[model samples]
Target: MGLLRKAARAMLSLSLATRPAVADTEIDKHSVDVAATARAFAQAAPLAIGDSYDYAPGVQGEADAEGRIGDTDFKLRLFGAWDAQDEERRYADIRQASLHWRHDRLSLGAGVGTFFWGVSESINVVNVLNQADLRQAVDSKEKMGQTFVSLGLRFGNGELSLFYLPTFREREFPERPAFGLPVSQRALFETPDKGGDIALRGLFYAGDLEAGLGYFKGTRRSPLLIRRSPTATEWTPFYIETENLLLDALYLLHEATLKLEAKTGRELDQGFFAANVGIEYPVYSLPGGIQELSLIAEYLVDDRGERAETLGQNDLFIGLRTSFGDIGNSSFRGVVSYDFDSQGNYLDLGLEHRLSDYFRFETRALVFLNAGRDDNWLYPVRNEDFIEFKLHYSF
Candidate 1:
């Protein structure tokens, strides 16, 4: 980690020194934020495979640097994690190393970056830019950076952006099986190695309404696992070409917000559609300036139903978040996702509070109910419920 930090600082210094300075611009305005976190987990039940451990521990470090030279801005971010129990869980990623320049209404950028699309919290059907970092968590929030070139033009009420991705990143997986599944073998791509994916997006704002339309033609970020042989137990990831159209919108009403995200696409020879609609309402200064409460609900639907590889198919997600306005800046969140047909559900509880200027702590518990049901995605890890604690320090 020390070497990594030094190398990143050296690279940033070299880049800044080579850039042309501007008289009116703050060329020396550069800052780096680094954080180190340690985590420990306590499993309610033993894992179905491997050592069947009831406890595990891990540590991770992250660094983000941002700066500007004249009219161009640059950013660099790095992350790495280590796990004692699973070798595959120990990995590193250059989540972002990109540069952008803008003049008038035109903007251009190139390098490794992360792009996210969608409005719903439960399921982001339209987010297909970067590969998932499954080793980090199952929430699908963490992603690997993608190499690409992007161009954008701003309009009076909206903007149009085009992305040309010249490369693809394979999804990350852990060595130990979690959801009652076998460890997959190497990945196999149906398209050429030099993935030439393209995406175009248009976003418009009208008063309280915001909407976006997007299209993508590229190698799918999620893979279809196929058995190696009829009798083999191993599976291999097969990346397929896909063409997808996506729509997302948000409307603000009083203290409530409406969110919707939908996608229709063709992968290989199969056609599918998925949609998610959600609403969030927040009450500020609950009981007079001590706390705030937010209510959230969302419904997810997928045409593929049982055949869908992801979660949130015919499911309802309900969440409650509470913020205690105090010096420590404490917060509490609870979410439940219930599958309508399979009678399966998931529960997550999280709490976090700041300890000091440079330290913070968080704890989360995940519970799977009716996970053994045949039609439930959690059937793979019926006994994988666990609680995790994390401590973080920022510098």
Candidate 2:
């Protein structure tokens, strides 16, 4: 309690000391902006209803406040959402609430924040800082906010960052009736103590080539399921379950990135290494520079071979992205992924267009093909193909 109180006092003092200076500078510069952004949507399927499908509806609201005071910058964003699918779907969270102080070669940040540190189109193997909010999206693009203190220093042509995460958050999953795991046998998370994780990363860029190396030691954001009993079968006939089935495994991760957006990483004690080697290059441009098309290809591999869940042990992902550089700022992206070991494949398509300055429209579809019992993680969701549309309004 004493340490926590001291930390709180320090944070409060830091904020108070810089508040007035920032306000005066902003008033002089006449550059202050505060606003709110929000999105609401309803999701359904075009096919007839089935025992495994449910109509999911949700809405998200957020407010952001940002300003600069002299050499310090502060931003606070509050996010909340509600989903009609289940009771656990409704949540209120701090998306980003942080103060950033910068010097000539040093930068410091504190409070809850979010950051991504990977270079992959289909998956992010090196980004392990924040847990995914899977209920919002299964693509792993959306992440929950993490509270931490960060320090970054620039030396020569490289930058080094150190982070201290004071708490750990678990990944969010959708209800069983949805496309993910069943809710009947929910996972039991092993919560961690305060200040349970530390991370370090160094990044360097040279000409057209860039590279990064990172190390993380802490409780895993993803949980591993363990059977409570050898013969328990209430969760599913294929697998056993226990009362305390969710186990949070502690791990050390070492990752590296190279040019062409290649990423490789290994988890200590996991006995496997994973790699995503890919390149994203623009194919051509349309006439008058109104549109552009880009090609993407990546080979994914896991040393665990065919026994891995979630990610296929050996796979290929090919995608195309088209951007309409018009007033509406429309874009379309699609990807097809195939697993060599199980002969399973999936397709993902997404489209987005702006209706007005304050409104936008988006749609996405996920389709599974040739998925069978041999597939590790995709077999349960093979029959859950669906399309989703959303209209977003921001101001």
Candidate 3:
């Protein structure tokens, strides 16, 4: 680790001298702190065994089964497949680490090891949000100060936060853009990634419900970026980083959203201002498990704008997922959503089972039928399939 730091500093010195000089825009103090943070996380992790350990290794895997019989989360499943494109990939990730602390209402965390970065393709845009990407910040595990910090705070129902986070909300592959956006859960976003800016959020109670509103500069204050120009046209393609400056507000009336996972699909990069609002209502109650359900919906609207990539059409859809049990955890989940004036419809089902106290399995499948008849806006449509067999380990 020490050697890597020396090499990185040597490399940075040479690179910094070549950049066009903008003293006012220089990153002197910030760079120093970033370097320090990276170094601190790379030092070897202490194991309970002993201090004499040299090398360490581990593996992760999942397997599942389904027969259209629903228990808690799925209504129906045609078939389940192992090594499915959606579940497992070639290069499964190895190790991960994070220096996170949460006490009272204040929280601070930063990761320094390689881990998971969610997908960004067509079908996944609505479901996948930002996760973690430590490898993108490091020159190597040995390079100290190779990671980034995320500081978050909560004052009552309101909160403030900042960090160099990567969010691949919407993506379009120039070549073969129709693929269910094959993304490996194990890979990190490309290096030299970007971060978010000053964000403020507040909460309140209305009648018998809870809700909130929030906004952030997105990237308005980012030092490395000066302007945001997203073009939504067929010839060019306006790609908004989803990390840009914009306003996002939500008011979720909480009730029966327990143990439920829903999905929606659309694009929201660049000038697209996306917003989501939701409320859940409990329908029934039982003995072993309580039968509960919730409804949800979200939208992304991009008014007439520059034509650089895709058509500036509004995308609106709604979905629902429900589970049953005394703890609000059921073995079944069902979802259905529709798109208007553009493409087709979507249906997704999921089921979970407890094989034993130490073993469990989950099954999931999704179908994206012909949603777009003409597809002038490139609304993707195909009989896409996915399944998951997850085995979890608890301490």
Candidate 4:
């Protein structure tokens, strides 16, 4: 009967067989429609047991490649000029071939392929060095497998899970990447089972909160930190990770992470912790039904001064998400973050577009600006720029 109500019905007419009516003064039909759409989406989305891949091969023209290593043999501008002439490119092989299968109570997944791993990083320093860059110095392709066996207990509100990771390969530790490693070590990039290793991730959940703890005791040396200073070039850090997350739709959520590692040479023990808490609100609509808004603020601490002294002093990132119209998942989101007392200041802008039930594409650009001269900047003094582009697909 009203103009706005008619608009919502018009939009729903395209998909729903009948426009569900709402109690004029009790609840909004739009909220009902939104909730219905969410349920439909959750039911139609691709299952966890599926195969997919991504190729994020790009270039980093000039990244202070010659700053501390060999400044004389190569002038700073030479690397910059080389970048201008021919930048470095990477072929991630996002994934190789993989298979998935899921039943009412159990699910399994395995693959021998290309995948991008979020190497355990010191959260304090947001740009200490990318995990890809770290692994690039050792191994290229990492074989990955995961299994989820859940049993609905506690009146269908609680579940349990188990995960596994096998020993893959090591990175090509070039004497000095300035030159490059020999063909022998580079060949190890694709090797599998050359060593023995196993990792376990156990999770327990109920209602809106969950707790998880994991351990990795492997022989393969995949140290997340490698220090190469003139005074002491040490290879310390084997592997370690500790993390947890709590998620809720209508109330509140909290997430936290802490990592510890012991290296081969220095035998240094390093770690850091990050925690965040947020609020959520559920809203019903005038046309369909369920809609919601969420806000979160995160804080991180890095105590890896023994390894990468320039890792992180402190870090914070906040995000806001909203859903509307006939959309199923979140239709739009915006984020703001402040980090790096070293390289000056950094900001990120991102956008996500859903193509279908099995595919999605997203692009984000980060800009770095030197806030001031030397001592004033909390980060390193590198006039470098970083940009990341990615696409996700589930079969």
- List candidate 2 stretches off by more than 4 Å: 1-53, 176-195, 231-270, 285-290, 305-310, 325-328
As for TM-score, the candidate ahead, 3 or 4, is 3
In candidate 4, position 223 carries an lDDT of 41
For every model shown, what is its TM-score relative to the native structure?
0.88, 0.78, 0.48, 0.44
Tens digits of lDDT, candidate 2, 1-395: 44334335545655675563634444222122222222222233222223323455667667777766576776766777676554555777676767778789999877777788767778666677787776665556778878778899998888999988876665655552243334333445433243458888888766545567777766656545444577643232112111111111111122222222233333433444666677677755356545778787877776654333244558899999887856529999999999988889888899988877778778887777668687765775565566776777777
Worst 10 residues of 2 by lDDT: 240-249
Cα lDDT listed for each candidate? 0.75, 0.61, 0.32, 0.31
The reply for model 3, stretches above 4 Å from the true place, is: 1-88, 92-96, 101-108, 112-147, 154-157, 165-271, 285-290, 295-320, 325-329, 376-383, 390-395
For model 4, the run of ten residues with the poorest summed lDDT: 31-40
lDDT of 3: 0.32
Clashes of 3: 36
Model 4 agreement with the true structure over 1-395: per-residue lDDT tens digits:
23223323332342132222332222111110000000001111111112111122322222111111111111111111111111231222212222223346554433222222221222221111112332122112223211111122222544443333332333433221221111122222212333333333334455654443333333323344333344432433333332222121122234332222112112233233332323333333434632555454544433343233222334455665555445654354554545544334445455566667755555544344444443222322122223334444433
Highest-TM-score candidate: 1
User: Ranking by lDDT, best first?
Assistant: 1, 2, 3, 4
Winner by lDDT: 1
Instruction: Compute the lDDT of residue 49 as modeled in candidate 3.
Output: 16
